[model samples]
Target: MTVKKILGAAAGALGLMWVVRAAWGIPSAIGASMSAIQPYASGAVSYRDRHFHNTEPGSQIVAGSARSLLYSALTRRNAGHPRGVIPLQTPVVPTEAADLAVTWYGHASALIEVDGYRILADPVWSDRVSPSAIIGPTRMHPVPSPLSDLPPVDAVIISHDHYDHLDKATIRSLVAAQTAPFLVPIGIGAHLRHWGVPEHRIVELDWGGSVSLAALGRTREGTDLVLTCTEARHFSGRGLVRNTTLWASWSIVGATRRAYFGGDTGYTKAFAEAGTALGPFDLTLLPIGAYDERWADVHMNPEEAVRAHADLCVGDPGHGLLVPIHWATFNLAFHGWSEPVHRMVEAARAAGTAVAVPVPGQRVDPNGLSPRDSWWEDVG
Candidate 1:
C-alpha cells in the first residue's frame, strides 16, 4: 500500500478507537440523573431547588470561578506519586469481632469491626476509580483482599456517590459476594438501582436518618449495628450535574462500641453537632488526603482531620483511635503522596490525639492499639 493509504487507515482506526472508548464510559459516567433521584432528593431537608446544599455558607467550591478551576487543573504543585511500592497486609477472616477494630484496605475502603459485628465502609476494590476503565486514577497498590475474600459483613456503608467512594464495579461485586444491605446516603440508591442492585437490599437515608441492624441483619442474632447517615461538607455528581445525591459522614454504633466514618468532608461545625448528639466514639476514620487550596472547603486537610477527630470524639482528643483514609491509593490532589499522614501525625501529637496509621489491609484494634511505625516514610 502507498504511504498515504496507510496513514488514512491508521487515522480511521484511531478515530474508531476513541469513539468506542467514549461510548463504553458514557453509561457509568452519566449515572443516575436528577429525574431518577428527584423523589428521594426532594424529601431530604438539605435538598433545595432540585439539588442538595451544604448547610455551611461561603464554601470555596461554590465561590470558585471557572478560570480559577482551570488554573488549578493546569498546575502540578506536588509530586503526588509514591517513590516505592506501598506495603500491604494479608487480611484474615476474624472468627469473632473485637470491641472496636478497623482494617484499612487503602483509600476509603475499610472494615470496621465493632461489638462482634462488621461494617465495611466505602469498599472500592477496582483497579481504577473512573467512569472509563482505560483512564482516570489508577490504584497505587494491589487490593489487599479480593471481594470473594471478604467475610460476611452486617452492613456496607457508603458515604457518597463520588467515583472514588461509591464505585459501581465494587458495588456489583459486593451485591454477589455478601448478603449485607447497602446503607447509603439519600439518592445514592438511585445509582445502585440503575446498576441492578436489588431494591430490598438498599437502605437509603437523608442526613440524620438511620438503620438498625435488627432490621437489616441477615443473622438470627440480629446484630446491634446502628448506621446513621450524618452531614458532610462535600458535593456529589457522577456526570456534569452535581449534588443530585447527598454526601455524608456516618455514625456506626454497635452495642458496646461506636465509630465515626468521615467518608469525605471539609472542616464543618456539623462535626461538633454529631459529637454532641451521637458520639464519644471508640474509633473515627476521617479523610486526610486529596485536599487542594482550590477546593479546600470541600476536602479536609490532615490538620483539619485531626481537628474534626477532636470535635467528634467530644474534645477528648486522646479518646478515640483516628485512622486516616482517602489517601495513599489515588492521586486526587497536588500534595506529596505521604504528606497527609505525616501532617496528621504532627497535628495529632499537638492536639493530644491518638492515631493509628494502618498499612493497607492491616487491622487495628483500638482497645490495644499498636504504636505507629511511620511506615510510609520509607515508601514515600
Candidate 2:
C-alpha cells in the first residue's frame, strides 16, 4: 500500500477500536475522556433524514433552496469571534433558595426552583458539547456553578441525548451527589441506563405524558411536582447512527408555580400542543440562540421565541416572562456571540413580551424581573 493509504487505514482502525471500548460507560466523571460513540435518541428514528424536515410530502428543506449537508451547518462568523476572552460582571451565582427562581449555569444548564422544589434542566457542565472533547464546539465561557456545590435537586430533566444537554460525565457526577430521580423523554433512558444510572431512579415520559414526583417519590417541601414531557421539532443522535432515541421539551409544574423548559428544537407548531395540554407557564425557558436562516425553522430566533411563548400560552403575547438559554456559553453557531439575544430583545420590545437576560449565574423570578440592556454588547 502507498504510505498515505497505509496511515489512513491505521487511523480508521484505531477509531473503530476506540468506539468499541467507550460505548459501555465511563469509569469516572471527574475527568472522563471524550469518545466517538454518539447515541441516537429521537422519536422519529425511522425517518430522521431530510424527509422529516419538509413541511409537506416532498417540499424542499428551505422554501426554494436544495438541502446539502455542508450548507445545513449553522452559520459561522470569523470577524467577530470573542477573541477567547469573556468577563463576568461580578462572579454571578445562581440562587437555590427561592419559591420560584432560575439560575443560568451558562448555556442551557439551569437550576429551577419553584414551589420550594429544585429541578435542573439540560445541565451541560462539560467543557465541550460534542462526541469528542478534543474536537467540536468548546465553550467560550466557564460554567457558573460547580457540580460538586450544586444544591440538592428534586429531578434532572434531560431534553434530549445531545452531548450538550445530556452529558454523560455530568450525569454520572449528579447521580453521585444528589438523590434525585432523572426525568427524561422516551428512549433517553437507554442512554442514562447505559451510563450506569439505576433503573429505579429514572422516569421516562413521552409527549404529554406526566410523572408526579410526590406520587413516585418524596421532596423537601413534601409537595408533589409534575413534569410533563412536551414535544419539540428537533433531531437527536450521538454516534454514527441517529434518532434511535426520543427528543422532547419539558413542562415542570410545581406546587406553587409552573415553568416550561424547551431543550433544543427548531420552530414548530408543537409548542401549541404543549400549551393546549399543559398551558400558561409562569416562566418559559426557551432556546433563543444558535439560530440562523439556514436552520431557523428548527431553531427559533429571539422574536420567534417570543412568538413561541405566545403560542404556548395560547396567543397571549405577555402571559409569561421569557428567560433565554442555548446561547452565550458555546460556539455552536456562527453569529456574533450575543446576536440571538440582541435580535430577541428588539423583537420582544416591539411585541410587548417580558424577558430577563440574566448573567450566566444570576437568578431571576418570573415576576419582578430586571431588564439588563446591552449586557452582551460588552462581550461582543
Candidate 3:
C-alpha cells in the first residue's frame, strides 16, 4: 500500500480503538442493571410499581417537553459556563478531622467533618457526569484535589444514583484507596457491588434509617456519629431506567455537632420533617444549582435552598452556617454560572441566615467562619 493509504488505515484503526474503549466504559458507568437493583430496592416504601416515587407527587420535568429541553440544552451550551477561569484551592486536610468543618470539592462533592469524624458525600471525580465519557456535561474546572489526597474517612455517603452524584470511577478508586464503608441509599449498594465493591463495604439504608459510625467499625473510641438517610424530594437513575433506587438527603449527627447534606432535591416539606427528627444542624451543605423552571420539581432554586436551610435548621433561619453545593463545577443548567450563589446570598441575607461560599477545596470551620466574600463575581 502507498504511504498515504497506510497512514489513513492506521488513523482509522486508532479511531476504532478509541471508540471501542469509550463504549466499553458505558455499561459500567450506567451502573447496576434494573434487574440487579430490584432486590435491594423492592422493600422500600418509596418503591412501588417497579420504581421509586417521591414523597410529594411531582414529575422530574414539569414545565417543558423533552424535545424542547433537549433543543435548549443543545442551543444554549455555553449559557451556564463561567466567563472566566474558575478559581480552585488546594485543600489543607488536617491530620485529624475537626469537630465541625467541611471542605467543598465542587459540584455535589464535599468532605464533611462532624465531631472529629470525616464523611465524604456524593463524590464525583470523573470528567463528565454522563454514561459516555466523551459526551456529556464535562467539568468546567478540574477536581480541586485528587481522591488519593483524601484522608481516611469514617464513611463515604451517596445521596442518589445519578452519574453526577454517584460516580462509578470514583467509587472504584475509593475502593482501592480508602478503607471506609460506602453508605448509600437503597439499591445503590447493588451498583457498588456491580462496581466490585466488597459486600462488607456497602451499607444500604432507606429514608429514616440510621447507622452508627462505630457500628461500621471505622470511628474513634466513644464517637457517636449517627448517619441517617433523610428524605429528599428527588429521583434517581443512571440510564434510561429511572428511580430504581431511592434518592435522599443525609443527616450526620455527632454527640455535639450535627450537619445535613441535601445532596440534590427540590423544595419539599420533608426538610422541616428532617429538622424535627434529626437536625437543628450546626452546618448545612445544600445544593443551590442545576435548577431551572422546567425541572423545578427535581432541583431547588437558590431561594428554595435558603428556605430549605432554614427548615433544616428547625425554622431558625440564622441557626447555622450554609455552604452551597451542586453549582460552579458543571454547566448543567441555563442560568449564569454565578447566579446561584448570588441569589443564595441575597435570600440568605433576607432570611437572617449565615452563609459561606467556599471556593472548591476550601475548607470552612462552621465555628470560625470568615466574612462572606464575592469570589464568584470576579470569576464570572
- In terms of lDDT, model 1 sits at 0.87
Q: Backbone clashes per model, in order?
A: 0, 15, 0
Candidate 3 Cα misplacement greater than 4 A, ranges: 1-21
Consecutive 10-residue window with the lowest summed lDDT within model 3 = 365-374
lDDT of 3: 0.90
lDDT per model vs. reference? 0.87, 0.73, 0.90
CA lDDT, candidate 2, residue 30: 16
Model 2, 1-380: lDDT tens digits are: 99999999999999987776544333332121122112322344333432123221221135655444345443334423565456543233344456677878877899887787889899888897765645567777777657887877888999977788888879889989989999987667767777788989988776678888887766665677888987777766666444556678999887677889998888778887788877788788999987767566667788788889888887887887888989888766657777788888888888888889987777786655565666677777
- lDDT tens string, model 3, 1-380? 99999999999999998898677779878888899999888889888999999989888887447888888878886888988989899998999888999999999999999998999999999999888867778999999988999999989999998889988889999999999999999999999999999999999999999999888776676777999999899898888878899999999999999999999999999999999988898999899999988888889999999999899899999998999999999888888899999999999999999999989989998767543789898888
Better of 1 and 2 by TM-score: 1
Candidate 2's C-alpha runs over 4 A off are 1-80, 89-96, 369-371
Q: Best candidate per lDDT, number?
A: 3
